[model samples]
Target chain A: MGHLSAPNDIEDLLRTLSPQVLGALVRRFDDFDICEDAVQEALLAAATQWPREGVPANPRGWLTVVASRRRTEMWRSESARRRREEAAFASAPADIELGAVLDDSLELLLLCCHPSLTPVSQVALTLRAVGGLTTAEIARALLVPEATVAQRISRAKQRIKASGARFRLPPEAERSECLAAVLHVLYLVFNEGSTASSGATLHRVDLIAEAIRLMRQLHDRLPEDGEVSGLLALMLLTDARRPARVSDDGALVPLAEQDRGLWDAQTIAEGAALITHTLATAPVGPYQLQAALAAVHDEAPRAEDTDWQQILGLYELVRTIAPGPMVTLNRIVAVAMVRGPDAGLRELATAERDPALTGNHRVDAVRAHLLEMSGDLPAARDHYRLAAQRTLSIPEQRYLAARATRLAPDDHA
Target chain B: MKYLILIYSNPQSREIWNSFSRDQRAAGLRDYAALHESMVASGELIVSEALADPSLAKRVTSHEGQALVTDGPYAEVKEYLAGFFLLECPSMERAIEQAARIPEAAFGLVEVRAIMALDGWDI
Candidate 1:
């Protein structure tokens, strides 16, 4: 593998080093905008030189030094016009100590997850600043307009600066709230990939992989946080089933119909171990509960053995812990599977009346399935068509459209 | 760097301020006083003031080498410039820091633009 200088290997190395280098520079220099730019410059420098000269022995340190130097130059130019509060940066130490450059990804995460920015801004900035992805790359993968993404990232940075959010972890009293913000951002990334909101494709492996990579980093930085492990485990186990989530022709495959043989055993084992450890301590966080739910499904040898009763119990626990219409929707499905379609319909009747879920496509989709299960194919087809029209995702529309068609009767003259 | 800090207030914003209770309005005004005091102490505050509502404003425009006067603020714009502060700050970030401190900024918008120094002019 020494001679294997694959392009992907270098990209992966740079991705890991970029955030650490950027985080280190931000901590040292206290300039979010300048640190981000300098880090990008350093990464560009590495990409040009590393292949020809062989990878550096200490790439992270090398990038840190280069970015620090670049940051100093930026200060020099800005200060030339006018003296700034950070004027001391001109004489930044030449040898940036390796030890002083702590891996403050937590700090970076907190900064990127600053509450002042909108959620879309937070996601865009998190992907660029900490995920080490370029705006074009992010736009391309997520299918957002490049201009929109660029504007969002810059605006988010300005908001963070203007709001005066410190580029460090919040004090102990507020740590959990800030941590929750960070976890929410990571989960958004994961969800966007695992189930894309709108796009030609059903799934984006690039984004899913990036989310998992960042979660692994978060887990490493925060080993004691059971929720972190829980999130990572949940992502891994869910991703292990990705291969069977879609058919060869790109049709959606429901979990019950997926081929168990297609699930990645190694990933499932790793996630199962993490969840087992997490549960030994009784992790009551939503992520842990979801992981436990996924684990039960993964452990089942066949679809009929899914342990729906246990899943129903877990769904109830999730509702109690984090009550929301979405959880209620999931529980409604589980009830249908465990008890009967009529039971599920009864549970959803309230949701149908609730203003929040009255027009929700997912609720409609679930209702369509329950109706189909209860032998009301015509009503199921109508609801499926309603769901197809309501969803923004092209793939989801196709899936629901197919469902509606499957329920249609044979046309006879 | 000298920055032109433009403070924009929507006429509708008055509704918000009016909706506040007497104590809430007092607290907001107190916060503004503190913000103004700090900026003045830092010597970054050059000139600042609040403006009357847009209904009391006028506009002048020239077309085809002729001057034309119009009533009210620019009709094409939803948010007219309500007031401004000319600030001599060290950097853009510092200007933004000051802009964010403005009490109205939270309720409306604050724009920080660098004041161009043409030739030897300095303020």
Candidate 2:
């Protein structure tokens, strides 16, 4: 807390400590719902007071004390109003060791991403509990109503309570599975920010930053876990190109067309170094392979200089380990880049049989690109139009429609 | 999931209702009351209400800055929405089961439709 020079730095410090303080409280109080609310109140207090009064000697300990007091006060008033003696006893534990709170960030993350909750609920609760975002902030980041975010978070916590899950890690048999759920939630949060599915704005940077921050914390706690490191690296590598991902006029610039000069060289280097270290040291997971793929993209000085051979090999490994429709589509792009457009089109025909790919705009967009490369201008234009019509993202629609328009006159000629 | 369970009224159903004995009509009302009570007890029902006469409905259209009014319950349509139950169910199957419990389902006039969220799909 000594280097808390700027207000932004203080905000970051608060966010980083929010989960640790909440984890400590919930572990001791054994009441996640009340503990979460108390922690939010504590965070709000810190946000307002930290900059004015100067940073505390131990920010995390200070937050835990404040939140614990709030929790006791809340329960005490409730118990008195209801005349429930047990509530008072439960609220004020005699052995409260304020200074000896252990970091329970991993356990908190597992609880937030509980499998009983729906993906939407998991995303909302994870943002609030682990990422340290408020309901209004989460709603703004997700382009959802505040009520919806609040409902999801509350319902998720209730479900966790109903599941009878404790504030600790799962059993050895279930630990890896639970950790996978946590990683998936973080991946979803990052994806939501990387691509605004149905919004006017292309990127919700707040969510992206939150995802990376949470992933970094996870990595710090479980440094030996390859997938955690891989995910952190992947997020960094993907986010590094964000500066050049959009045009001045707010249109999305596809990867091949983006000006590489605008990419964050420092972030790329960091991500590259991390992934390179991970792939060498740990057993390769899907995320690590994806990070490797992203690293290849980031290392290329120009779009034309991209090593499609290496990328294609990596996509193959990613597909083998974790097959997904998007991975299939990306692999086809690499196929076209390496072999030929006709070869890619042949692969696309087989991939079109996948139920998940049916009616997906990205498939159409990919097909259009391949057809354009194969000198099938009319077909490419039609596919572009289809893609433009199918996509919900405004920027993607604009870009696809522009591609179709660019080829319209050529059709007549 | 939230669903709108719509009960449709047609000329045939209305004729059958009109022809029912007093005892039968009262029994029908009892069935609806029972269903409403069960839904409320289960925390499934958000709101439910019967409609006014469809003939009283009016259609409004703007034409060159002028508002034009026309009689609704279009003559060509055979079925009109009579009442609806707004229910929060766990799944489509549950909503359908609730819709089947409605008295109008005997006439094949009850329908269950999922309510769309703001994003069209969940995150």
- Highest DockQ: which candidate? 2
Model 2, A278-385: lDDT tens digits are 999999999999899989989999999999999999999989999999989999999999999999999999999999899788889999999999999989999999
Stretches of candidate 1 off by over 4 Å are A1-5, A81-90, A100-102, A196-205, A411-413, B1-123
Model 2, runs deviating above 4 Å: A1-10, A46-58, A76-95, A98-102, A196-205, A410-413, B1-123
TM-score of chain A of 2: 0.90
lDDT of each: 0.79, 0.84
TM-score of chain A, every prediction, order shown? 0.92, 0.90
Model 1 CA lDDT for position A103: 64
Q: lDDT winner among the candidates?
A: 2
Model 1 agreement with the true structure over A105-160: per-residue lDDT tens digits: 88898899998876777888889888888888877665544665676687777777
Score every model by TM-score: 0.73, 0.77
lDDT (10s digit) by residue, model 2, range B62-99: 99999999998565677898999987656778899989
Candidate 1 chain B, poorest ten consecutive residues by summed lDDT: B114-123
User: Interface Cα RMSD for all candidates?
Assistant: 23.8, 7.9
